[model samples]
Target: MNPRDTEEMTATMKRELLCVLLLCGAVFTLPGQEIHRRFRRGARSSRVTCRDEKTQMIYRQHESWLRPMLRSNRVEYCWCNSGRSQCHSVPVKNARATCYKDLGVTYRGTWSTAESGAECINWNSSLLARKSYNGRRPDASKLGLGNHNYCRNPDKDSKPWCYVFKAGKYVPEFCSTPVCSQEKNGDCYFGKGLAYRGTHSLTVSGTSCLQWNSMVLIGKINTAWKTNAQTLGLGKHNYCRNPDGDAKPWCHVLKDRKLTWEYCDIPQCSTCGLRQYKRPQFRIKGGLFSDITSHPWQAAIFVQNRRSPGERFLCGGILISSCWVLSAAHCFLERYPPHHLKVVLGRTYRVEPGVEEQKFEVEKYIVHKEFDEDTYNNDIALLQLKSDSPQCVQETGSVRTVCLPEADLQLPDWTECGAFWLRQARGVYNAPSLSFLTASPFYSERLKEAHVRLYPSNRCTSQYLLNKTVTSNMLCAGDTRSGGNQANLHDACQVNMSVSPYSEPTPG
Candidate 1:
């Protein structure tokens, strides 16, 4: 697939400073009410709980696995040659059949023999999973070794495989299972190869790949990211993957016995998703006053003021690709001509240009066809940057594209919400999380981020929203605690988001 087509990562939600800010600081508006503080700290008495759609799907998938496996043949094997070795049998609950290639990821059958007709070594064997390969014990949960000697594929192998005793040592061999077919590459991957599940463990120079869940490689990639290894689909087996938004599938390989990262030389059914830059060495840091370098994907959008010499801050956008900026549809409802708008990338200050900043004129914009100005439903817009070159902006220290969210992410109920700020004059307010109800003028010149939390679906219903229609796409967030920062929020966005006396007819 074209990298441009794949780079529409953040375009999924189409948020900007004003839109994404959502209710980070809780200046929400209901149709009949002037303004409503969407959040109030210590007010969980009336709060409703919610489980996102992804959670429901996974729960359903697990329920489906129970029925068919009970009818399959159960097997038993002795796990180790050690004095403590004991014969164990497959547990009924974990037994699974692979009907499709994608099912290979979730396959948990009790087939314990390898292609060489060798008995598969039990994962619990001291010489294998229990021993430290290189400073890290082989991860059992990551490898999906559920006690039995069942053949499994934790790595993206051609089919289900396991270690077997051969030639005085344990070696890996494929198993003939109905779950994952021997044909390796049949609908095995997802977009841009982030979900690449091929058996391409060799680098361009034919170096063998290290296990993705290897403690050494996990610590090398980013120690902080180790916890997220499973979430990124990195597991026990070493297979080339694009877990961190790289241009192509890659893995940590041993070169001259030193661990290093390299791109896999294996070719796929489709073209690799190319990008303008490589993954950064480290993750961005967070604080009250967000530096532009921490938010490389941010775009400072502005409108050419027809009545004045200078432009006015329109809205904050996020870079999805080298040439595309995703923002709210309401920001363009005025129908401003493309020539009248500009997008500044890699900017530090909101107004004063940063040394690494790159500016581009707006080429054109495409808003959701069903956008509702009144309800802000389908409130997404994509702006194309006018540029002479194909890559409108180069990926730099202060400029990069954000990865599109594909997996469940498994965020908590109180997910962090931030507002990307844009102000006219250079001013700094060392504050936390920002929000807005309307366009405000008194924001600080420095890019500001506000810490915000998500609200349950019940709290953001039409009855609570002044009878305005609320859609699934529209998220409600806010700061529940009312404290010293209220003054800063009042002055920062300069928005009159305070609740009106009449708006609050009920005591609750």
Candidate 2:
């Protein structure tokens, strides 16, 4: 009995020893820190003082040799546990740091006290950096600022420094300075808490700034554009570069010398005084007609006696169909009347000064049923020409019939949508002899303007529709996501509009 039991015990002992040796090798040779390194190193070899002023800490000085305990190039965590008299290491030039009192130190990833019996930490540096142990990207969490990029490096090329933050799995959102001296080509921007194309002046409040290039605007200010002095408004107070701790705020100077303050203080108000142009409210010089004649479906409506027709204003019409004659609706308003109405069939507004004008006569000028006498909703009317002149498709080069749509269609909702309008260059149609350049149609905004009122279905619905059925009959267009002005002079030719039917049209 004694021999058998001794042999069995000996065999078991050998197996246990082998198991211990294998386990030790596996723990020491892995990719991460060896088990021996789990305890703290009495002191680190070097120090790295955070240099950037924007860094959160108060000039934190850290151990450089802490790199080995940390996965090099990876983030490592460390903690401050309110140890009043912990010792720290200070680095000397070209030499590893020696321990000193009142500074913190960790040995093999664990915190220790110079005196005996300090509690081990749960949130020691290593544990803090390794909270979500799935080996994923660190969560650079922030409060108030929903998700944004937390940048490790800054870009040199961009103005108004920005931080790159990880928005989501590989996405990033940058938080940049909004006060820009000039707009950058593709950079996104926000001002007064509104986003817009980095290049355009932001005039709308709470309006998200958009992206777009800039162009010098040349034209007399329409009376409508005149600033209201009493309503002058203030912008933001931007910090000046001067060290006196002063801030300069921009305020919009309104017409008539009055001021309004919303976000900041109004600095100055001076009249531009540019209200003296004598040309018609809207007119074409002569060049926009070339392409107009090329479109088989296009029709031109000319208004006669735009200013002072006898007893009433007269307007000419182009028979788009038996159901429609394209004429200016303004021609038949109560303020203008239609007693002097006339329809000029073949047209030549320009002639050798003395030659008689070309044309046709109107039996009646039927203005649009919903046309507003004051606002001119549908700027068109039908002139029943004397004895329906033949639908001359040939004389009218491109005589394609324009189809109409129902007015109640629903449009999508948006913070804002752009509108564009186009007018051809002068002489582009009839007399190629003159400049054929036509200016763009006035970029008129709906609802947001001082004149246009929002429709109930359009504004009062459960949601707002930008191109709803009400806009079906109206030519509607918009800006690209870039936020550029769709009505700028260069893009003016691309503007298009449609006629929309409204159930409750504005009363005439």
Candidate 3:
């Protein structure tokens, strides 16, 4: 019975001991510390308990002297003797008092004979305030010193209190300043807890918190935001928490409240109520022909196929009048006939031949009298159509008319007016390709026309007819770089003439 029973009991005891250790470990671990000591519970508290016998004794003495003598008689004394020969005062059983026998002689005892010791401070203003001494609560209602008789026996000197005896002060009851995250726990401490009190907190620019007797409301947590282009206002947004974000109600005893948001970075106008100026759009109907007619239809028309023979030769023509076609005088200088100078009616492009082919009998080729063979001026010439075909007079898609300046009519002859003969002398006779043609009565369809540009004689290689041959009446219109180099060169795009002979009848 002895050996077997002893072995079993020993093993069982070891198992039980291990279980107890595990349970205790789980229940008692020091928080925020690496050490875990079961012996710590019995250690001394850093602060003495207020209810302890020694503390009670000290408090009782303070209260006794403060009441019977200080409050009722406004005077008290102590019996302790201090140096500088010696100092003495009457002893009060409850209080550890102090007395100044002379200027520099102070004695610590139970009571003092002095009327009101210099060491003891007093507060007599309507709004009483004071600081703590010996870490004790002053009898605020007693009216001995700084105490605002509001809260019954309020822990007066317990806080670093501030009092305003006068009405005005630059400093408010609570002041505030922003704090950075690097601060102690992101905390902006104030006067009472440290040495004085003011408002401060832990909030970021994009974030917010509360402070200042809970009077200050801060952050954009409850506001709303709208994108720059948003059609509606704050309430219309589904997700806008606030102008900034939803960071509201971060209420605190001393927080300054604010609402902020990341404003939409709108580079363009979002709302239209604000005044703005924009160019008026000219809305016309019809096509390029209509555009040209809306203004003076006189364009520096390009007459292609000047030398071709047969009835299909003249690729295009410019309307010199209802009866005449202004063309390259050299086109007829060769003594060409109706077949050899076939005029393409309403020719817009050379590659795509005109839909209607007009067999015109060159009635008479009247070249400008001064036309020179070398530099061809009076390069201007009128090809009077045969009087036989009356159909030529009618306005058809193939044949049309462009007004001409009267014999004595004068114009500034600007290149933009299609008077670009000046530019033709120069190597760079570049014109913008017309794509958007204004609507009007002349053009049937939206046709893309060639832009005509006139470079000055300064850019010309030949000087013979630099300014003479390419006269003011003679204008040049067409894409200088014809092939496909023109940017807006669509097959049917047209440049509608804006200023028309109908509008300006005669040049000013």
Candidate 4:
């Protein structure tokens, strides 16, 4: 053997050993580096693969018991021995089972019960056993009972199962009252998920989850129900029962600013309907004398005639308020002084005065600010009477004020209305015009009345009035009589003259 060969082989062997050591070190270091990188990416590996044999056995038993009762894909389990414990989950396996026990089979504390012969507790039958033992109620505090420790059954179609702690142990009962299921999850659950079965509607006035068997056709999600329920003093959420008995439950909801039941029919509010007023008996026909106190608002206006020395009959007015009279603004065209005019009320005849007649001096007069003489628009005026008392006139059977119509009030076309005037020949409203007579031959000095029908605004426009400007504020009316012995034609002009104290006949 040569010494050089032996030395070379020895060096080779040492180098090979050093290379092997380096490879082993690299293998351990690389794995640690890779694990650190995986950790940075939120990946983790389990250090322990095998669980305690006793724990595995308990978990398998619990899984078998709990798989059937789960309403959803997940099921939660908890340790009965731990006082302050959390729920844990397991994969569901048996889809056919209907009953589930939430707490695993164990005693309620960490103390061993092997010598005492205390068997593992079964949540379903444990309550019944406790109730029967000693014939006394089970104290919840001593048993460490909580809402999480419950047994649920999901198979029964309707009125399934609800277990309530009563008479010391949980007994079959209805989940009528809300109970906390999980304090950390803020989930207060009703039992059997059928609290509102067969009911049309449910009101959750308090914050809690109400489980039911039927599907919700209409649900106010989040805060929508709170915002709209019983709004405007209306009743609670309205619902209709499923007539077919197969469809989901539905209810009324407010959509597009309107309330609709089941997204279809509209629901009527309690305040819907038209207001009505009492109808009077007296009527306006062709030319006739009005009953003595029939039109109590009538007033006769008088003015001092410029050509004559004393005051003479001018026009008529309607008393609207105690101190206010409504008339046509055109009546004041002559601009008579307020002191020179007088108003007489409760008078049926122009010359012959009534026993209940009252008189007043004009204090102030106001023509409409927007009066248009060319179109006769806004021809209304108000007159204030001079009086020592706040109320200018006392109301009586022959001196009542007329009610003003509301601003939005509408009347049908062709509605009949009355016109009133004064005639000297006839002492009352009855005064017929001579047939074939022209130029108002029926004129009289005493109060007279006639009827006319209202004309539509379109007919009163320039197209019908020989191009006369008619405005939206103006009203039109015409006589509707025909045939032999027809009544004289009544007009708005005649009505205006009868209701205005300052009106004078226009010169032809």
The candidate maximizing lDDT is 1
Best-first order by lDDT: 1, 4, 3, 2
Point to the candidate with the largest TM-score.
1
Error of 4 at 283 (Å): 13
TM-score of each: 0.38, 0.25, 0.26, 0.37
> Candidate 3 on 1-508: residue-level lDDT in tens?
7998999999999999999997777666434243323225667433222222222322222222222344343333211111111112233332221111222112222221111111122233322223432112333223222221111112332212222223343111210111111223313221112111112222323233322212222232232232221111122222211122222212122224333333111111111111122222343332122222222222222233555732222212355444466554544555654433434344333334445434345555565666665654455455666554222443443444544344454433225332212111211112222222223323223223333433333322223233333443333322333443232312222221211121211111
lDDT of 1 by residue, 415-466 (tens): 5444443221111111222211123445456665555554455665666555
- For model 4, how does the per-residue alpha-carbon lDDT over 1-508 read when each residue is reduced to its tens digit? 6999999999999999999999998999889898786565564433312222334424211122222234777654443321222245554444222222233221222211111222223333445444432111223222323223322222232322334445464455422111222222212112222111222343222112222211232353312233322111112223222222222223444345453434112111111111122233344233444533667777777888888698876666777677787666667878899999998887766777888899999998888777666655666667888887545776666776665554465667766665443321101111111111112644344445555555665565566555655566555555655521223323322222111123321211
lDDT of 2 at 124: 16
lDDT score, candidate 4: 0.45
Candidate 3: where is the Cα deviation over 4 Å? Answer: 1-315, 347-359, 387-391, 413-415, 419-508
Q: Supply candidate 2's per-residue lDDT for 479.
A: 30
In model 1, the Cα lDDT at residue 437 comes to 14
The Cα RMSD of model 4 versus the native structure comes to: 25.6
Count of backbone collisions in candidate 2: 67
Off by over 4 Å in 2: 1-289, 296-318, 334-339, 345-358, 373-380, 388-400, 403-475, 478-508
lDDT scores of the candidates, listed in order: 0.55, 0.28, 0.30, 0.45
Give the Å error, residue 253, model 4.
Answer: 62
Error of 1 at 339 (Å): 1.5
